[model samples]
Target: MASSSSLLSEEQFLCPICLDVFTRPVSTPCGHNFCMSCITSYWDNASFSQCPVCKEQFQRRPDLKVNTFISELASQLVSLQTSYCDHSRVLVLFCRDDNTLLCDVCSSSCHARHNVVPVQRAYERMKDELENTEAKVQQMIQERFHKVQSMTESVKQTAERQADGFVSDMQREIKELQRTAVKLRELKQTTDQLRFLQSYSSTSLLPHTMDLSTVSANKHLEMQHFGKSLRKSASQLRVSLDEMNTEISRFSGGTAESDAATLRYMQQYEVNIVLDPDSAHPMLCLSNDGKQVRYNMGAGMWAGQFLNPNMFTSHLAVLGRRGFSSGRFYFEVCTGQKTEWCVGVATASIQRRGPLVRSSCCGLWAIWFLIDKFETFICPGVPVHMGKVGRVGVFVDYDKGEISFYDVENATPIYSFTECSFTEELFPYFNPCDNEFGSNLEPLTIVPVCHVE
Candidate 1:
């Protein structure tokens, strides 16, 4: 057995297709052997059928059969080589930098200057590190899972509480009505007795009719008030729930989880934005969905609705449907490969007619693409040199008096405004500047937040 093993080297049984021991070994017409699965897979990807080892091409696909003798020899060689590293070199050291096994010869040749440790020592260290990482990852997953469970449970509890409140209120109203009905029955009996006494005594004993106004007046008012209050409270709660759901969707899974921290942080103040057609310039065309705006050359002649005084007479601009006077808000806009456009927030009272300044001093805190360059539209506009930005995110903290812009695609900061006092409500401002020779005609699309997976 020793002599046989010494004669059979690991190279003899190694299949060129797999670079490992042959399995279900098959012999080709070229007299070369390979693992059946490996050779088949290789040919599937290759344009022509050929022997991998001899490079001999076959005009017709060659028939292959298992080489039972070579297969048995390979099995025995695999068992014998287990104790020998790579079937020839014995692993005595571990190269820490490369995280690989090394024989004495390999250590001297390849890992000459690397930090080499005993194989057992490196194995123990790596095993310990892997265990710690696994534990930490498990703990993090549990924490997040529990957080989600808790939130779901909280929602259930809130719904239960609201339902109980509604039931109790309804019960109270029913009890009040029951008491009123009893009083009504008692009044009817008293009236019947008085009428009988009056007919017998031949004298008037009761007013023309009983007044029900006193009994029903307060009851009607109470019910109306309860309905209004309950509806208002329910609406507020629904709004809060919807906001939470929006935040949850922003970082659902996959690549979004990789960016969860940032996306979740930003989603706290995410606002649903729509373009306000009333504020659009006459030459600007607003899409039917009200989420897109573009400059139209022929739109200037459509005079039917352009006569409105509030319409932008000269400047190509539009304001968002909603305005923010307090707290924080964020929205994103897509320039859609358009090079010339303007986007940011503007005070509600900015000048909209004739020759107007587009600067912070003029109530506009914005960034614009002017002459093929991006720049902040503050006084003495600061030039911003950046690559093509398909989507731009704008965040505003009204109370803090801060406005910041971001390149959404690259997750990079573009510019910011700070320390200025905001006296009025701010509206999302958009200007798909005039279509310069039809080159800038693409619509500025208001893009929904894209959550990557």
Candidate 2:
């Protein structure tokens, strides 16, 4: 008769190699078992390692994966047999001859001639190991799922933010353009009123006149000479209106911001604008025309960290000077001996930011015209308006009597700061195209902040 445990003992366990019940467990292509992750990694680094099974030579080792399913199944069966035999209340057997073990007296007797000892003590020693391993697998899966789900959600949020930013940028720009239009109407009214007054300036101011310097000191007498002051006020008003108009136009015609892009490092978009006298350094030459920021001589005393007697620069506002493109804008600044000297927009200039700049510099900003060309200067301490790049737009501050740079079409303000010292001479400079001035050595550097769609 066949023994009850004969089949179980013979068919239960598999060779760590071959992955089947131990039937001639010869070594395989690897010294390790049928599951070969270990031996493969070992031989992979060795110069020449023969296969443990057939002693075959391999130039390079291939990737290997363990058949963990078969290993665990066999291991579990062995474990079950370890405690199944009905030998005693608590059975354990150790083979002193081979330093091996058996779970019950039956196992020891079957493989007799080997010294035996109880196995209950050994089994108890490592009872929780298998359960802990299974728990770790579950935990690993959970962690992976969490990472994937959170990553997807974060991506969606970032995309939505970029979209909202673009829309807000667009709406603000449109409002600026409207304000510019309104200001233009007001400016036209004010101009007509003042132009008429200019025509009759001699008659109006003939009754009373006072020097501008004296007017500064004597407030009442200056007020009495309203006629003379009327023409001057009108001229100043015109200049202010023109500055606003220019800013509005510039912001009213700008490009859109780029798509949401992840920038892990500053190297992606950040660029160093350095100047060097030698080796094709960017120069601050005179730009024959106007309409852009360029390099020009400092006529008056202005002190800052950078105070080179013949070096401080301005902007060229011309359309097609030697250093400028016909329609595309560029920089005409200076570079030192490998020294960084940059002049990019504080932020992107694509969206319509008339309102933003207007709010910061003086409020009531607008883009009075299309294809914004106004030179809006931000007051000191005021922040710059953010926007995309390349879009046309403008910004205006009618209430504050200030103008700010903006994308004329999109309406994203390019400038946002407060400037208390900017004078009328710094406004448009007569478009700079009609009259030539300044060198265009290193032109206005325009690094794109957004996609140039």
Candidate 3:
């Protein structure tokens, strides 16, 4: 037996295939060394026989022989063994740096944000994003796979035109390409799940807080007193809750306390807008609450302008998470002389501060904070997806060359901007344009049914 240190140059003796000292060396017909399985798999399906290493033609399989000298030497090179530290072989460390989790203490100390998890359940809740990313990867891969196979078939068709009998060969390759497409899709699906590691490892839900320093100190103290008075009625509020539950059950049970008359949901405001440079009167309409307004522009009231340099026509969004806490704000409109101007989002109160007067070639129009600030600017050629708040309507002042709103949300074109003085309205509106047009004012109405999400 050769001494471990006297085994000659380890680098020279290494097999290129496995990047290790050969375990069982077997010389091929052309003198290439391979582990038995590696070489056999290489030649198993090939019809034309040739040495994979040297490309030497072999008429038939040669007598195989095992070289025992190298095999015995490989057995003597024992595998390495190790053990983990007693304190933290299976620790879940929190990283202070990234607020993420680390399995080792070394990582926990450096990453400030990392929170150590001693239990597997720490990551259990965070697995959804990982799974979602995995799913997205699979979906994107499937899309790409179809693209690749389509391209492959196209190329095959072109190739078959020049080569005889290639059509049949191309048809055979088609099936193989489809299988490859599926494999590619699956690869992407799993690879995208890596982001899941950081999400669960470092997630922390901190409590929200706000200081009551917004209003004047005197007003703030007054509000605190008012808040205390409100809290005093907490017991009374509990009693009211009981009454409300009784009323709800009574209504559901088809029993009336006194008289049973159902009331329709009411609109707080009605809306209408027009760009009449001359004289135009604001129309009054009855709201759902049976209240009337002179000229209330609906949520569909929107204007198209070059808000961005590229002019992406984003919709008039009512702010607030789910618009839960939104109130009315002011808006300012700035028209362009060259038909290239910028419209930015500002509190609708900002527009009200200025005198509502008609200015130069630059035109500005705004509705005071009567309702939530509607982000009603539109781009020449841009499509938008107004999420959640389904289909909206918009009125177009075709003659005065301005878009207006007459009806309320989910409006099915209650009015149109007729030649003399007509208007239209809809809700949750977004208009997309492909190219710019001078004075090409337009309106957008999304289909309510299409709001799948």
Give me the candidate number with maximum TM-score. Answer: 1
- The digit string of per-residue lDDT tens for model 3 on 1-453 reads 984445645564566556667644666777777654445456666776667667897886553444556555544432100112244343344343454444475554554355545334444444554455445433433433343333333332222222222223332333333333332322222211222333333222111212212312232232223333322233334343333322321122221211111000011121322221111111112223321112223323234323222221232221111110132111112111111111212222212221323221112221211011232232222222221121222322222332322212222111211122212221111112211434322222222221100
- Model 2: weakest 10-residue lDDT segment is 258-267
lDDT string, candidate 1, 1-453, tens digits: 467668889998888867888877889988998987688778778899988988999996665546779987986776556434553765667777776666788888878999988766765565454345434433433333333333333332234444335434433333333333322222222222212221221122121222222322222232323444444444544443333333232222223222333443464588898999888888889999889999987754556766776677778999998999998888888886685888999888888777567555789988887644678776445577544567788878787677877666544567777666899999999999985634788999888775311
User: What is the Å distance of residue 44 in model 2 from its true position?
Assistant: 48
The Cα error of candidate 3 at residue 148, in Å, is 22
Over the stretch 1-453, how does candidate 2's per-residue lDDT look in tens digits? Answer: 874444355343544434456321223445534433335444656678666556677664433323445555554454445444465323445444443444455564576665555554433322333234334433433333333233333332223333333323323433443353433322222212212222221122111212223212222222233333333333444444445444433332232221111111111322223222111111233333322233433433334413432221332221221211112122222121111112222211212211223233331222221121222333323324332233332122223333333332222345532332322211111111211222322333322332221
Root-mean-square deviation of candidate 2: 34.3
Off by over 4 Å in 1: 1-264, 302-306
- Model 3 TM-score is 0.18
Which structure is stronger by TM-score: 1 or 3? 1
